[model samples]
Target chain A: MSAPAQERPHLLRIGDLARATGKSSRAIHLYEELGLLQPATRSSGGFRLYEPGAVERMRWIDLLHGLGFSLQEMRGVLENWWSSEQGPAAMEELRVLFQRKLEETRESIRRHRDLERELMEGLAYLETCRACATPAAPVKGCVHCTQDHGMKEEPALVAGIMTSPEPGHRSGRGSFVRVEDIG
Target chain B: MSAPAQERPHLLRIGDLARATGKSSRAIHLYEELGLLQPATRSSGGFRLYEPGAVERMRWIDLLHGLGFSLQEMRGVLENWWSSEQGPAAMEELRVLFQRKLEETRESIRRHRDLERELMEGLAYLETCRACATPAAPVKGCVHCTQDHGMKEEPALVAGIMTSPEPGHRSGRGSFVRVEDIG
Candidate 1:
């Protein structure tokens, strides 16, 4: 007679774990080597066997890794979760790590936004050509037609943007490309 | 009588350009090789000669590079500035590059914000410990005080955060921090 349905064993091999989790076998092996994971059991043939939960564990590793956590840092967070330490101490250590990561993420976002502003300015300067019905090609072409038709507000504008402090602003610097710097 | 100070030339050599711009000589040479900069003149001895304006040009190149433009791309942009075909075509092309870069920057900022939220939630869970008049040491020290009285929001909260999108959302896929997988 077949085993009871609920008691049926749905074991997976190491290869299955890698394929199912969309990770490489090498990565799975590396995780095990790092002590971040352990095979659920070893078959009589000495092959590593895993439960369904192994896939989920791999995913958590990928998630934290994407968030910029290194393997060592992730190991620390994960190990603490199951460590005999269950409350205050565990939470405090994780809080420090999370806070530091949050700040780093914020700083990166700020830099991205600044780059965005600079690109926007470059785009705007190019837009000035909109007033020109039939513009020249670009490099030496436009200068011949427009010469210097009173369209240069670079130094002063740059200075203003540099000194101003918007909300959520930090001591970070500025970009906002110069008008003369682009097409 | 010798030439007046103002009448004296302000020509600089390669070493002088490096010192003036705070760039490595190799970098300055690379910029020249990339056509992003040019020596104002060349001495009879084959030394590179640069005008004071070369320093300003070097600064612009540095700024644009910092804004994420490749040396090759910057060369293309600067070259177009003085191109004989300067006009509608040049402006349109630069606009496209700038606009694409802008969108990419916006997307990065969005991702950063999402990460910020996730990190904030992790932090909030940690803060929950503050309510425990006496949090355990941290790692292996908290269970004795309160085994599971009311310390389970972390998993559920993390799950909720993973599933929700506050605003300005797009279908950029997802992160792998599922709730059922971690503590």
Candidate 2:
């Protein structure tokens, strides 16, 4: 007597899977080798076939990968999903992990901001130096002055003074001149 | 007809500088070669001598190095300070540069946190799978059903189920099982 035939499970070819999961055929093959995924069956022509739920499984893997999980880590997670009897504990653990990661990210942001402040201050100094090279009389009664000397004077000390004039001035200078004061 | 005597600048020998700046004599020489610093003069015996302020400048360089600034960048900043007529402009440019570096560092930290989260989740799933390997009962309801019912049942259908029982199991033979009511 012939044995009764069983109903076949849902199956999809490699091309169909690639399109559905937005992954390349090569990547699918790689995942199978890593034991991260399994094909339901093979056709007479030796083409790989996936079951009905394979797409969902692939989606989960893709999401984890996007979140920076390694292929090995994803395999472990899938294994837990497949064999664990208590689902709540696993889900809880996952939530805790996410929270910890968020905290670390916030700390990193704080350190980066501190470094940013330091660099900004450095840049400000360069701008001030460039402005001083201009051939203008010192601002009289400016906030930088100790005394309120409002009267302007002629540029008599221009010869003795080591000046870093603006670009294209009479002195063909390559380097900036270190001057203690503009006046 | 002797020329008028020029005022001599204060100078420090290599060993004296090492003591003042807490740097090795070799390091001081390296700094001189890199142009990050300079000695005030050379002795008759070819020994190097530094000005009083040289130690202070070296200390500043050390500070910037600790903060992760490259020698080249430090040199550029120092050159600007030595040559620039305006201190404020140079400081401003430095501030902007620091801000850019801070942003890059923050991005790196964010990526690290994401990776950490993925790893933690993966580890949690592995733990649950290990717990569910031993079947508590002969045949429990489907794993998916248990997840929906809010019951803590052994994971039997999930992929990557642990083959060995967890530590401290009395019987240590059957699969870990926890059945939950689907309804």
Candidate 3:
């Protein structure tokens, strides 16, 4: 009785674990092969069996993966968990991972937003130009005039906002702008 | 004289143009192929000759490309400028493009910031855990408890982020803490 309890702590078949975790059986096998996860016991026919608690650990691994942690990183974290007595260090590591993921997500959202804005502006400009056949007269003495605007100084509001190139091309002299210099 | 001015525009050889733009000849040729730029004239021997103004246009193209506009997108913007007589429409399109680029830059910055945050958090968590050998008491409640306090509730975010599976496994069920009824 003692041997059976030790070998099989609520033994679970591979299929049962896969369904509970929403992972394919093939993936489960692969994880086992990788040594990331191990089964608690083997059946008479040589089927893998897991303890009920394995599901929780698997979920944690999945969450970390989703947050963009590499397998190596995950291993490092897991090793930390396994080797060290459970304490503040493990919790702290988990927190750090969370913070990194949050930052990445925010950045992605910001980039998409920028793209959307550019498309809108381009479309709007096209529509306006279509309506007006003539180039707007170069505004005289206007700080924003493309010709008068120098790279040295910019209005505070427009600083780091946008970059505009010189009005016309001059042969032999290439006029190029750096996108980063723009706002 | 007028015909010559229109025909050649004081053509500069490709080498000189490349020197002026601080770009490699290969890159210049690639740009030409992409239709982001062109030489104003061709030599009798089929050499490319750039007019004085070609350099500036190339510079602008380079800048826009760095700003994340694809070659095709740059071409569209340039076409509006070169072909359209209506200045207003062209200006409008430019405005739109600028707006879009700005947003994209912003987003990139944001993601980087988020990543930084997450990394720091992970590092801190690791440090704390390392320093303290005791495991923090497992929080009460269901599996979702940890997730509720941590991950964001955005499906779009979930879809966009790429994650690698656990190590040593081709596939494995990912563990996640479902904080709530996040669909």
Candidate 4:
């Protein structure tokens, strides 16, 4: 705050930029090669030096990655940004791309949610058989172990069916795909 | 249902299996090579023939993929099932692996949820500027455009700053990493 705007050290060394942005030195180099970043000037020692804002630019790159923009897509967004017309049409182009990404992320979330549910079902079925002390063949096939017993929860699978498949066995019984495969 | 199990024609050709499970014929061959699936029998013409149960098994494979289980990890899970002991310890190993997968899926969901929010904010901001009839430069820099227009939502980015960064400019203001980088 004490230094005048013109008096400030306007550019940062590559090391300083990397440290400030929390990116590894190699990632910064990769970003440069991808044309995502540029140096304000080179140091006397022939090092890449960045303007004050490069820190912010690199951070945007980080966020864009999380937003599901690949490096190529990120480059495209930056290149056509605000376009030459700088009007509503330019805005629409960005809007459409973001919209697609939003849907993709939503689909990913849904898939993970289903996977979590499947894992939970497998775990719960295992829990129900915790006290089982019967013979392996019968214990693995205990019909009671699959029943709700009294709780109105989802039925668990027979562990024997999951670990090893008997020929002609339908392993998809109570599988999540039964629900997902439906339109 | 009326036919005896022994009397029923139990094997399906590779094409029939592909159609039944909605997977490509190539995928079934890959699954067989991975040892995740096996044929009930082969046809006299050397075509692969599978039991009806393979359909459910393939469906499970599809679901497991969504859960982020790589082919190797999934193969390990199937191989370890029931292990040699066929006891509680064998079950515990499955539990631990499923538990890890559940956590991974939960994390993926969380990331997508955050991305969805960021995209929604960017879209809403663009919608606000949709009505502007002012000069391109001024409209792009308008402070009012960034401020909340009485809605109880997060403020939008400063328009000029988001849409156009001058050469050597940093645009990281209000970014997710601004929150993420702090702690």
User: Across residues B1-183, which tens digit of lDDT does each residue of candidate 2 receive?
Assistant: 222112233557777778787999888767665666654445444455556666557766665664567877766655654455444444345546555655665666566565555445444443443345333422122233332222243322222222211112122223322122111
Task: Give the TM-score, chain B only, in order for the candidates.
Answer: 0.56, 0.49, 0.59, 0.69
TM-score of each: 0.59, 0.36, 0.43, 0.70
Model no. 2, DockQ: 0.09
Query: Proportion of native contacts found in each model?
Result: 0.41, 0.07, 0.16, 0.21
Give, for candidate 3 chain B, the lowest lDDT window spanning 10 residues: B156-165
Which model scores highest in TM-score? 4
Pick the lDDT winner: 4
* Steric collisions counted per model: 19, 49, 55, 1
Query: Residues B1-183, candidate 3, lDDT per residue (tens digit)?
Result: 113332354667777777888988898777676666666556555566666666667666655655677867766665555554444544555666676676766766665565555455444433433334224543111112233323353222221121212233333444422222222
For model 4, how does the per-residue alpha-carbon lDDT over A15-102 read when each residue is reduced to its tens digit? 7777788988888877766657766555444556567767767767877787667876776676666343654556666678777887
Task: Give candidate 4's error at residue A80 in angstroms.
Answer: 2.1
Q: After superposition, how far is residue A152 of candidate 1 from its true place, in Å?
A: 3.2
DockQ of each: 0.21, 0.09, 0.12, 0.20
Report interface Cα RMSD per prediction: 13.3, 14.9, 11.8, 9.4
What would the per-residue lDDT of candidate 1 be over residues A1-183, giving only the tens digit for each residue? 322112215657777777787988888777766656765555554555666666657766776775787877666666555563545655666678778888888888877777777676666666766667555443434434543334464322121111211112121223232222433
Error of 2 at B39 (Å): 18
Q: Model 4, range B9-50, lDDT digits (tens) per residue? A: 675777777877788989887777676776655444445556
Go through the candidates in order and give each one's C-alpha lDDT.
0.58, 0.49, 0.52, 0.59
